[model samples]
Every structure is written in C-alpha cells, then in structure tokens.
Target: MERIKLHIAYDGTNFAGYQVQHNQRTVQLVVERALSKMHRQEMKVYTSGRTDSGVHANDQVLHFNSPMTLDCSSWRNALQTLLPKDVKIMHVEKVDESFDARKSAKEKVYRYQIINQREYDVFKRLYEWHVIKPLSMERMRSAAKLIEGTHDFTAFSASKSNVKGDKKRTIKSIDIWEEGDGRIIFEVRGNGFLTHMVRIIVGTLVEIGLGKKDETCITQALETLNRQVLGLTAPSHGLCLWKVIY
Candidate 1:
C-alpha cells in the first residue's frame, strides 16, 4: 500500500459539511465515494481539518492509504473525473508513510469575507456576508491587531466546541483590508483554530467597526475566557480554509 496526499478544493454550498454522517450529503462522503469507485474498494480518507456547512476550502489537504498503483497524475485525473463539479482534486502525490494530513500540518490560514455596502450583489451573495451598515475599517484594523500573538482563544470559540485539550492557540497574524468596492477581507493565520474561532473573531471585529465595542473588548475577552462577551458568529458561507502549511 502507498500513502497518497491530495490537495482539494470545494464549494460547500450543497454539502452538509466536510465530515460523513448518516443520510447526509457531505464533502468527505462524496470524495470517498468517488475514490472507492475508482479503486474498486472502500477508501478511507483523512483530512487536515473539517469545514462546516457552507464553509468553502481553497486548498484543503487529505491523505489515504491506497492499494492502487496509479501514478500521482493518474490518480488526480481519475478522481477529478469521478468527483462532482463542485469538488475537485487539485493535486496528488505520494508521501512518506509516516506523514499525516492532520498531525503533520504546522499552520492553517483562513479568510472571512464581508461586503460592506448599501445593497448586496446577487452574484456574490453566496460567497460573502452582506452588511448594510457602513463599517469603520480603521477600528476594525485596530481590533484585528489586538487578536494577534499567543492567547487563550476560549472566548472566540463555539460554546459547545469539543476541544478538550487546550484553549490556547498561537495566532501568527490577523489582517483586515478593504477593497474600493466595499469588499472587506479578514485573514488569520494560526497554529490551530478552535471551532468557530475565525468566524467569532470576524464578528467581533465587525462589532468594533460598528462602534458596538472597542479594541479593549478583545483583551477583556481573552483574559476572561468568556464566550458570552463575543459578538455573533459570522455565517459559515463567508469563511474559507485558504491554505494549510506543512
């Protein structure tokens, strides 16, 4: 058997999530089904991380042990042909047996998009969050900078997240920028992320931009580890797993 790593990209609009579930369409289920058909056996695939429903991925990584001896290019082409239009295998390669898609990852980058405009565009509605009120980019940028560096991100995570081991995560950076057309992007890079962490951070920054909170709120939240102090969790559709660094 050979261990194969795949770089995948998908539009998560139709799937329940990246994980498999009974009677639910999911990205993992679809990818595994396509592989099983190509390899003529059930192929179990493991991913670096899971994306919730409506959360897209630009370059998610996954690995699986396969008995098939197809070359890397052949595997990519065959899998793409079998997969649906929304899910595509971007690259494939053989990796050392010891490499793991999840454990071997060193850092991950995520981006959340928001359109701060009077009216939302129909074409971009599915990809970005629409905010009616004008946002203060200066305040948001200030708040974003405060979230950088090592800190316990318990306040930024989902209340029911199953992360039992550690709440402390090292954030390498948090960048907020805006395009002239009112497209605002919040990008975050970190060693690891808690469930709903990026979305909550984005929402909290937006709240600061709208004058609902200030930069000091970030410090208080981190110090208290209080989930109730956080702003609303941004919608999943606005978030994307941009890259995974090994």
Candidate 2:
C-alpha cells in the first residue's frame, strides 16, 4: 500500500464539517466517496484538522493509504470529476507512509474576516462577518499581543467544547490588519486550537477594537475563565482554515 497526501480546499457553507459523519454530508465523506469510486475499494481519509459547519478552507491537507498508483497531477482531475464543485482537490502527491495528516502536522493557521461597515455586502455574505461598529485598529493590535504565547486558554474556548486533557495551547501569533472599505482581518497561527477558540478570540479583540474593553479586561477574564466577559462568538462562516503546516 502507498500513502497518498492530498491538498484539498472546500467551501464549508453546505457541508456539516470535515470529518465523516452519519447521514449528513461532509467534506471528508465526499472526498472519500470519490476516492473509493476511483480505487474500486473503500478508502479512509484523514484531515489535518476539523472546521465546524459553515466554515471554509483555503488549503486543507489530508492523507490516506491506497494501493492504486496514479499520476499525482491527474489524481486531482479524476477526483474533481467525482466530487462536487465546492469541494475540489487543489493538488495531490505521494508522501512517506509514516506521514499522518493530523498527527504529523506541526501547526495550523486560520483567518477570521470581518466587514465593518454600515451595510453588509451580499456577495461576500457567506465569507465574512459583518460588524456595524467603528473600530480602533490600534486598540485591537494591543489586545492581540496578549495571546501570542502559551497560556491556559480556557477563557477563549467554547463552553460546550468538552475537550478532554489539557486546555493550554501555544499561539504563535495573532495579528490584526485593516483593509480598505471597512474590513478588518485577524490572522492567527497556533500549534493547536480548541473549539471556537478563534471565534472567541476574534469576538474579544473586536470588543477591544470598539474600545469597549480595556487591556485589564483581558487579564481579568483569563484569570476568572468567564465566557460572559467576552463579546459574542462570531459566526462560523467568517472563519476559514487558511493553511496547515507539517
């Protein structure tokens, strides 16, 4: 058997999530179904990470083992014929059998985009969060730095996450940049992330950007692990799985 790695991208608007699930349509399910059709056997695929429903991916990585050997470039074309238009195989290649998409991944990067203006654009409705508030970009930058290192990020995670083991995670960087036309983007890179971590982080920083929360609020919220202190969790559609590092 040969292990194959696939570079995948999909619009997560219609699908449930990345992982395989019962009955519901998903990114992994569609890819695996297409592979099974081509290989003439059931194929199991593993992704670098999971994005919640309504989320999106720019270049998500997945790995699987298959006995069928085909040209890497042609593999994408073949799979595209079987998969939906929204879920396409950007690229594919053979990797060392030891490479597991999830386990071998070194880190991940995500981007949360918000369109801060008087009115939301209908075209980009599914891609960006619309915030109707005047924001202070300088204040948002100051709050972003507090999350640059390893910390017990209990305050920034989903209350319903139910993630077992350690809640501590190392955030390599969190940067906020302004784009013209009232758009602000939060680019975050981290070794790992908890469920809704990026959404909460974005929401909190937005509060700071609006001058609603001071620097002291971040430290106080972290110490108390209170979810109420942060702003509302932004919609999942605004978040995208930008890239996965191996």
Candidate 3:
C-alpha cells in the first residue's frame, strides 16, 4: 500500500466539523467517502487536527493508505470530483509510509478575524466577528506579548477539554493587525494548542482592547492558572486554521 498526503482547504460554513459523527456531514466523512468510492472498499483518512463547526481551513493536512497504485495528479482529480463544492483538494503527494499527519505536525497557525465596526457586511458575516464598540489596538497588542513562550495554558483552554498531565505549550508569536476596511486579525502560531485555546486568548484580548481588562491580566491569568479570569470563548466562525507546519 502507498501512503498519500493530502492538502485540503474548505469553507466550513455548512459542515459540522472536521471529524465524522453519526448522521452528521463532516469534512472527514466526505473525504473518506470519496476515497472509498475509488478504492471499492472502506477508506479512512487521518487529519492533523479538528476545527469546530463554522471554522474554515486554508491548509489542512491529512493522510491515507491506499492499496491501489495511482499517481498524485490522478488521486487529486478523482477526489476533487467527489468532494462537495465548498471543499477542494489543494494537492496530493506520495509520502513515507511511516508518516502520520497528526503526529508529524510541527506547528500550526490560527487566525481570528474581527470587524471593529458598527455595521456588518453580509459577505463577511460567515467569517468575521462583528464588534460594534471601538477597540484599543495598543492594549490588545500589549496583552498578546505576555502570552509568548512556553507556559501552562490551562487558563486559556476550554474547561471541558479534559487535557491531562502538564498543559504546557509553546507559543512562538502572535500578531495583531487591522485592515483598512476596519477588520482586525489576530494570528497566533504555536507548537500545540489545547481545545479552544486560541479562541479564548482572542476573546481575552478583545476584552483588553475594550478596556474591560488591562494587559497585566494576561500575566495574572498565566501565573494564577485561572480560567475564571479569562475572557469569552470567541465565536467559532471568527477563527480559521490558517496553516499547519511540518
């Protein structure tokens, strides 16, 4: 059997999420179904990670083993024909048989977009969080700088994440920038992330920008390991899995 790596991108507006669930449409289900149809048997695909419903992906990675011998171009064309219009196969290539998408991942970058305006755009509603109130970028940027480097991120993780042992993760950097159109983007890169970690961080940063909390709150939260003091878990639609590094 040959192991193939797939680079996929999808508009996650309609699907439940990345993983499969009984009777629920999912990115994995569609990808596997397409592969199975070509193989004439059940086929399974393993992804680098999961993205919640309404969250999009620009460069998600997955892997599958196929007994049938096919070139990369042929496999890409076949899968593209089967997948829904919202999802696209970016690339397909042969990889080492020992490689596993999730385990082989080195880092991932996630972006949370916010529209700091009173009015919302119909086209961007599915991809951005609309905030009517003005936000202080200086406060948000200062708070973001505090979260860099390795730390126990339990305070930023979802309460129901069930992460065991040490909850330490290394955040390489975070960049906060605003577009001319009044759209703000928070991009975070990390070696790993707990469930809802990036969203919670963004929420807290937004609160800081609103003057509800100070930049020192980030230091206090990390030092105290306090989830109670953390800000909201920003809506899933505002966030996207921007890229996965190997």
Candidate 4:
C-alpha cells in the first residue's frame, strides 16, 4: 500500500467538527466513508489537527494508505464525486510512508476575522464575528506583539482542554491588520496551539481593543497562568485553520 496525502478545504458551518462522533456529521467521517467506498474496505484518514465546530479550513492536510494505483488526478476526481459540496479536494499526491500529517507538521496558521460595524452583513454573518463597537487597532496590535515568542499558554487555552502534559507552545508571530470594509483580521502562526488557544487570544485582544482590558493583562496572564486573567473566548465561527506547514 502507498500513502496518499490530500489537501482539503471545507466550509464548517454544518458539520459537528473535524473528527468523527457518534450520530454526528464530521469532515473525517465523510471523507473516510468516501475512501472506504473507493477501496471496498474501511479506510481511516489521519489529519494534521482538529478544528472546532463552525471553524473553517483553507488547507487542512490528511493522509491515508490505499492499495489502489490510481493516479493523483484520478484520485482527486473520484473523491470529489463522492464528497459533499461543502468539502473540496484541493490537491492529492503520493507520499513516503514516513510522513504522518499530524506528527510531521512544523507550523500552523490560524486566522480570525471580525466585522467591526454597526450593521452586519447577512452573507458574512456565519463566517465573521460581528462586533458593533469600534475597535482600536493600535491597542490590539500592541497586545498581539506581547503574545509573540514562546510562552506557557495555559490562560489562553480552553479550560476543558484534554491536554494534560504541556501547555507551553511557541508562537512564531501574530499579525493584526484592518481592511477598508471595517474588517479586522488576526493571523497567527505558531508551532502548535492548545484547544481554543487562538480564540481566547483573539477575545483578549478584542477586549483590549475595546478598552475593556489593558495590554498589560497579556503579560499578567502569561505570568500568572490564570484563565480568569484573560478575556472571553472568541466564537468558533470567526476562526479558520488557514494553513499547515510541514
């Protein structure tokens, strides 16, 4: 059998999440079902990571072994025919068996989008967070700068996260910018992230931008490792797993 790697993009509005759950629709379940039909047997796909429900993905990666010798283009076309409209097979290729999507990943980039305006657009309501109050971009950027580099991100992670070993992760960079349409974007690149870490960081930055919290709160939270020291967790719909670098 040869390992096949696939680049997938999906709209996460309807699915429960990336992983399979009993009686719940998921990206993995759908993809694996299509693969199983193609192989005439059960098929399991390993992903780079999981995204929460309502969180989209631009280039989520996964891998599975198959005995079929179909070419890359044929595999893509066959899978696309079986998958739903919300999920697309961006690319497909054969890979060395040594490459495991999750363990081989070097970095991940997540983007959080917010529409800061009094009136929200119906089309973007499901994709972007709608915040009526004007946000201070300068304040948010200042707080984001403090979040760069390596630090224990316990305060930014979800309290219910199942990770028990280590909370420390390295953040390569955090970029906050604004568009003319009153849209604020937060793009963060990191070695890895704990569950809801990016969402919590965005929430804290939003609070800082709205003058609800001071920038120093980031420093204090990192030092204290207290979840209460940070702001609320941002909604999952606003965040997307943008890319994964191997």
Candidate 5:
C-alpha cells in the first residue's frame, strides 16, 4: 500500500466544517469521497487541523493510505476532478509511513481580518469581519503582546474546549498590520491551538482596539482564567488557516 500525503486548500464558506457530518457537507467528506471513488473503497484521511465552519484554509495538510498503486499525477488529477469547486488539491506526495499530519506538525499560522470602516464590501464579507468603528492599533498590539510566549491560554480559548495535556503553548509570532483603507489583519503563529482559541483571542483584541480594554486588562483576563471576562467569539468566516509547517 502507498501512503500519500495531501496538501489541500479550500474555501469553507459553504461547508459545515472539516470533519464529516452525518448529512451536512464537509471538507473531509468531500476529500474522502473523491479518494474513495478512485480507490474503490473507503480512504480515511487525517488532517492537521479540523477548522470550524466558514473558516478558510490556504495550506492544510492530510494523509491517507491507499492500496492502489496509481501514479501520483493521476491520483491528484482524479481527486481534483471529483472534489467540489471550492476545494482544490494543492499537492500530493508520498511521505514516510510513520509520518502523521497532526503529530508531526510544527506550527500553524492563522489570519483574522477586520474591516474597520463605516461600510462593508460584499466581496470581503466572507474573508473579513466588518467592524464599523475606529480602532486603535497601538492598543491592540499591546494587548496581543501579552499573550505571547509559552503560557496557559485558558483565558483566551473557548471555555468548552476539553483539550488534554498542557495548555501551555508558545506563540511564535503575531503580526498586526493595516491591510488597506479599512482593513486590519492579525496574523498569529503558534505550536498548537485549542478549540476556538484564535477566534476568541481575536474578539478580545478587537475589543481592545476599540478602546474598551487596555493591555493590563489582557493580563487580568489571563489571571482570572474566566471566559466571561474576555470578549465574544468572532465570526468564523473571517478566520483562515494560513499555513501549517511540519
């Protein structure tokens, strides 16, 4: 059997999420169905991350084993033909049998975009959250800085998340920049993430940028380890899985 690794990118605007649902459409369901057609059997795949609904991915990785010995080019072409228009196969290659897409992942980068103007663009609605208010970039950056490095992110993640192991993870980097006239982007890289962590964090940062909170409040939020102390979860449509490094 040949174990192939797939690099996939998808626009998750219309799908439920990455994992397969009983009846609803999902990224994994589509990919696996495409692969299953070519293999004449089920082809279970493993992904580095299971992104939420309305989330987009620029570079997501997955792996599956196939008993068929189809050429890589044919395999990729066949899968592409079967997948929906919103999803695309970026690359397909064989990797070591022991290599796991999740465990071998080194880091993940995500970007949350906000439109900080009076009006929203129809085109960017799926990719950027529309916030019609002036935001202070300095305040947002300062608050973001406090969450860097290895620390318990219990305060920033969703209270419902039940992740095993330590919550301590390093924030390798975070870059906040004004993308354009009314757009601000927050790009964050981390070793791992808890469920809804990035969206919750982005929500808090937005509150900070809007002058509702200061840098010290970020520390206070962390110290309290209370979900209610932070901001609401941002819309999932504006979040994108930018990249994954293995």
Candidate 6:
C-alpha cells in the first residue's frame, strides 16, 4: 500500500464540524465515504486537526494508505468526482509512509474576519462577524503585540477542552489589519493551538478595541492562567484554518 496525501479546502457552513459524528453530516464523513466508494471498502482518513462547526478551511491536509496504484492526478480526479461541491481536493500526491498529517505539521495559521461597520452585508454574513460598534484598530494591535511569543495559553482555551498536557504554546506572530471596506482580519501563526484558543484571543482583542479591556489583560490572563480573566469566545463562523505548514 502507498500513502497518499491530500490538500483540501472546504466551506464549513453546512457541516456539523470536520470530524465524524453518529448522526451529523461532517467534512470527514463525506471524504471517508468517497474514499470507501473508490477503494471498494471502508477507508480511514487522518487529518491535521479538527475545525469546529462553521469554521472554514483554506488549506487542510490529510493522508490515508491506499492499496490502489492510481497516479496522483487520477486519485485527485476520482476523489473530486465522489466528494461534494463544498469540499474540494486542491492537490494530491504520494507520500512517505513516515508522514503523518497531524504529527508532521510544523505550525498552523488561523484567520478571524470581522465586518466592522454600521451595516452588515447579507452575502458575507456566513463568513464574517458583524460588529456594530466602532473598534479602535490601534488598541487591537497593541493587545495583539502582547499575545505574540511563547506563553501558557490556558486562559484562552475552552474550559471543556480535551487537552491533557500543559497548555504552553509558542505563538510565532499575530497580525491585525483592516481592509478599506471595513473588514478587519486577525491572523495568528503558532506551533499549535488549544481548542478555542484563537477565537478567545480574537474576542479579547475585540474587547480591547472596544475599550472594555486593556492590553494588560492578556498579560494578566497568561500570568494567572485564569479563563475568566479573558473576554468572550468569538463565533466559530468568522474563524478559518488558513494554512498548515509542514
């Protein structure tokens, strides 16, 4: 059997989440169902990580061992034919047996989008969070700076996270910028992220931008490792798994 790697992108609006559930439609379920059809048996697929419901992905990676000897292009074509329109296989290739989708990943980048305007656009409602109050971009940037570098992100993670190890993670960078059309973007690159960590960080930054919190809030949360010290968790729809660096 040869190990095959796939680069995937999907619109996460309709699915329950990326992982398979007993009664819910999911990205993993569809992909695995398509593969089972192609291979004439059940096929187990592995992914880099799971994204929550309504969280889109621009470059998600996965791998599976297949006994069929189809070439990369043929595998891509066959899989694309079986998968739904919302999920697209962007690239495919044969990979070394040592390669693991999750374990081999070096870093991940997540982006959160916000429509910071008085009026929200109907078409972009599913993809962007709408905030009516004016946000101070300067304040957000200042808070973001405090978030960069290594820290124990326990305060930012979800209270119900299944993570068993320590919550220390290295954040490579955090970039906050505004587009001319009143769109604000928060892009964070890190070695790894705990569940809901990015969303909480974005929420806290938004609170700082709105003058509800100050930049010292981040420092205090990190030092205290207290979840209650942070702001709300941003909605999952506005967050996307932007990229995975191998």
The lDDT leader among the candidates is 4
TM-score of each: 0.97, 0.96, 0.97, 0.99, 0.96, 0.98
199-241 per-residue lDDT for model 1 (tens digits): 9999898888999977888899999999887788999999999
What are the per-residue Cα lDDT tens digits for candidate 5 across 65-101?
Answer: 8888888788789889999999999988998798899
Query: Weakest 10 consecutive residues, lDDT, candidate 6?
Result: 173-182
- Report lDDT (Cα) of residue 61, candidate 3: 96
For candidate 3, list the clashing residue pairs, or say none: none
lDDT of 6 by residue, 1-246 (tens): 999999999999999999999999999999999999998999999999999999999999999999999999999999999999999999998999999999999999999999999999899999999988999999999889988999999999999999889889999999988887899999999999999999999999999999998889899999999999889999999999998999
lDDT of 3 by residue, 143-190 (tens): 899999999998999888866888999999999998878899999999
lDDT of 6: 0.94
lDDT of 5: 0.88
Per-residue accuracy of model 2 over 126-185 as CA lDDT, tens digit each: 999999988888888888887789888888888889778898899999988888888888
lDDT of each: 0.92, 0.88, 0.92, 0.95, 0.88, 0.94
Q: Report how far residue 235 has shifted in candidate 2, in Å.
A: 0.7
| lDDT measured at residue 58 in model 1 versus the true structure, 0 to 100 | 92
Task: Let me know the TM-score candidate 2 reaches against the reference structure.
Answer: 0.96
- Give the C-alpha miss distance for residue 146 in model 1, angstroms: 1.5
Backbone clash tally (model 5): 0
Candidate 1 residue 131 Cα shift, in angstroms, is 0.8
Could you tell me how far off, in angstroms, the CA of residue 112 lies in candidate 5 after the best superposition?
Answer: 1.1
Deviating ranges (above 4 Å) for candidate 5: none
